[model samples]
Target: MPDQDTSDIADIEADIHAHLAEIAEIDAVAVRVYQLRVAHPTDLVAQLAERAGLQVAEVARAERHLARLGLLQPSPGGGWVAVNPESAAESLLAPVEQDILERRITMAATREQLHALSGDYLEARGMRSAKGSIEIVKDLGNIRSVIDDLARTCASSIEVLSPGGGQNEEAMRAALPLDLDVLGRGVRLRMLLQHSARGHRATAQYVETIVAAGAEVRCTGVLPSRMLIYDRHCAVLPVDPEHTGVGVALIRDTSVMGFLGRLFAHYWRTAEDFLADPECDEAAPPEEVGGELRGIERDVLLLMAAGKTNEAIALQLGISRRSVSRLVGRLMDRLGATNRFQAGARAARLGWLASVPPA
Candidate 1:
């Protein structure tokens, strides 16, 4: 053989050694048959097939593979013997390793070429192409991609006006992936949840979950529409808040997006925080706010009925007079009474006092 040919064969042997373990584990039937032959090195083909779990043809294939890898070479006389494994290891493995490296290099170069082509394509298309764009998305599947793309590209903040009770199970399941993505990217998320959302079981739970994940959420009595704005660059809103059967509007006009952002900010400040207070759990009984008769509302009512001043009640409860005053206002509103006297009378008339008994 020529000097170059000897060097080339040596290179091939090196790559085969690098990936010998990989080829050995490709298939179960093949591996089992090979292992059987390896364990009983001098066994004849017929006896090996009988002893191995694989079919006759499979054992024959395994034998061919072993011989091709230089692990099973013909003996000096007649049969075969297992060659030195160290000699065979690289001899069989190098070719596979070379093929993998070649393919990886080709794939990486192709990907880079494609990315450069894409950049040229985008440049010709224009970066601020959305200036006057009003894309109509009818399919929910297509809308999901649009939202996901915006979340991935958003640089600064994500503002959302999520109204109409809480999100349905289907919406939660679908949006969770993108929602988590934006939050994890260090984007400031300000969500405006409508007051009606507090009544929703899933919505409340979802709020608690996202709040724990570093999202800012607040509830209000009214919201303009269901919208998601990413960094004042674009906004997505249902064409009609009452109906999504029509389609959704993806607006890229700077003025429209700016207005959407302002609306979100205005509501964010005015809306109430999504509290994790024990009083807020919907699973608790209707009468129990935080604890049975342990609620500030009930305590305030009892104190008011006894003609105790807000300051006196505050001192006894170890709370501020301002809190006691606020509790009085809330108690009156919840009881549908006009004043503290009326609130206390209503509580007594409703058997709230008797339900607790002397403590």
Candidate 2:
């Protein structure tokens, strides 16, 4: 019974040695030296080597490695002594655990602070509730301020649709600073303008400036309304579609913004790049402005021969009423006709409607 008890004790010690060696990444020589050192704490390196069947140098190297791992420490008498692994693990890991706790606390505090600040911002902007999400600003100056604030806060993309032909020089000059600011922050700025804008010198110059500064500008003949969508989360629209200076609507409702986003996307897909030609309108043939019909102008004539209103012609040709009106005026001048009916009759008589099939 005594022999069996001793064998069991030896087996348990062997298992413990193997487990500790594997966990601590200690080699076999180091494990054996460490075990002997623990059993005979007063033994010097030479004595430990003799007992462990290793050279004195091997025991000394293992002692150094163990000391580095915190499993051994300098003894009061002189040489190193084996340390309790539980105490060593506590000493080694306490600071790491404290660092993790501190990081978690800091993250929580920052998160709380940001949330509170966001709440205040939403409340101040009158966007906290579904009903309050739409802010109506009647003053033109206030509208500009709100738009500037939105532009500054935008984190991603800004979509702008400016209709009624080219922007005037004064408007472009006023908008240049805000445009540069948006581009500087790495926010994508996309502007969609009317096709007629390309003919305006001031508009072309402004487009060149913004394009050089990383703004994406496109032009189409048609746009539903003057709209500005920021980050796909909010949209600002002119309250009065015909007269933008009347007021503006700042909409934060997700569903309405989503619809507006889709509308902008639809128009954007069909719009042409503003900088497609370096010379722009100057590259056009001389005959284009001399009673010779352009492609769009011809199409406008055909649609007008079908007795379409400016609105109907704009819809059919995917252009604005302003463009259709301009086309009709030019067609009348070319045909020497005084009224819509006279223009159509003279166009048909002059073979202008030859390509169009009879209805």
Candidate 3:
């Protein structure tokens, strides 16, 4: 029943409304320019650009847009003339609102229809234990990739055993990026380093950096192998100890992972905090060091029993060489020994050296 001329105007109005809907600010500026053109009838893009603090080219773009929407028209003399705003909104804006609502309803129905396939997806590959979870990654590069993927996917915790604390500078540099990322994610990290780690100057500094980032560090004289357990869901073990570049096995077997977790807990319970008293020998228990000597003196006896020189003892036990000499003298006098070798013998006889590893 609508007139042909009215239908044509209505279609144009809808096009203009859809264009305006894209950006509210642009729409507002366009409409305001229409109002200003009606009032003053200026054809200068520079004038409008100055008023909007925009480039002349930008104002020209808006001008061309409004001209196509019937909100603007070329004047016989120069610039553009504003069209009636009331008629344009009635024809364009009202119909566009209805169009937007209908599109939204159609989109909702489409999404629900797609939802029917979710069960098939779950059956295919949704569960955590999905097959192929257990992967054997060979070569150093692939093994490093798996570790990094685990670090990135890690949501909760990490367990690490470093028998030597840290490797040489090249290895440390290779691992520094991933280590920093894991710590930065606020994942809880519990690491075990060897008691002799402090003796390595570079390793000592590396331990401090990780400790400062909230990782829990401890020392133990023993650990079976270098391992990494992630969230109790995956365990990474080396294929060969001597040549780490050979490869590694990433275990996702739950039972094996659970055993690794239990093993770590056992060691964690007895491992001394890396920041503990410098005089303590975390590698050897206090009872085996004999109940008679002071803690610091026990430290001296344990190092002496291991046959470390005074300089090495000072470095490992965090004391001056001169201080180590004085402490040895005091321990010898206490045991009635006249020299370092005899003092070691007397300490052994007293059961103070029982904890030291046999030569």
TM-score of each: 0.43, 0.45, 0.45
**Sorted by TM-score, highest first, which candidate order results?**
2, 3, 1
lDDT-better candidate, 1 vs 3: 3
RMSD of each: 29.3, 33.9, 32.3
**lDDT score of residue 229 within candidate 2:** 92
Better of 1 and 3 by TM-score: 3
Candidate 1 residue spans exceeding 4 A from truth? 1-129, 276-359
lDDT of 1: 0.63
Residue 177's lDDT within candidate 2 is: 93
lDDT of 2 at 238: 77
Q: Alpha-carbon error at 200 in model 1, in Å?
A: 2.5
Per-residue lDDT over 1-359 for candidate 3, one digit per residue giving the tens place of the 0 to 100 score? 23754665477545533444432233545655655677778748788777766788866777787776556779998998877643443343445546545655765576567656644653553355643344546876777788889988998899988775445776666666777788899889888876667566777777678888888888765566788998888888875555567777677766778888998886676566776655532343433444455344566666664446677767665566776777676676676654444465567567665443321
Clashing pairs in 1: 15-93, 15-94, 16-93, 16-94, 17-90, 17-94, 195-220
Model 2 worst lDDT run, 10 consecutive residues: 278-287
lDDT of each: 0.63, 0.71, 0.65
The residue pairs in collision within model 3 are none
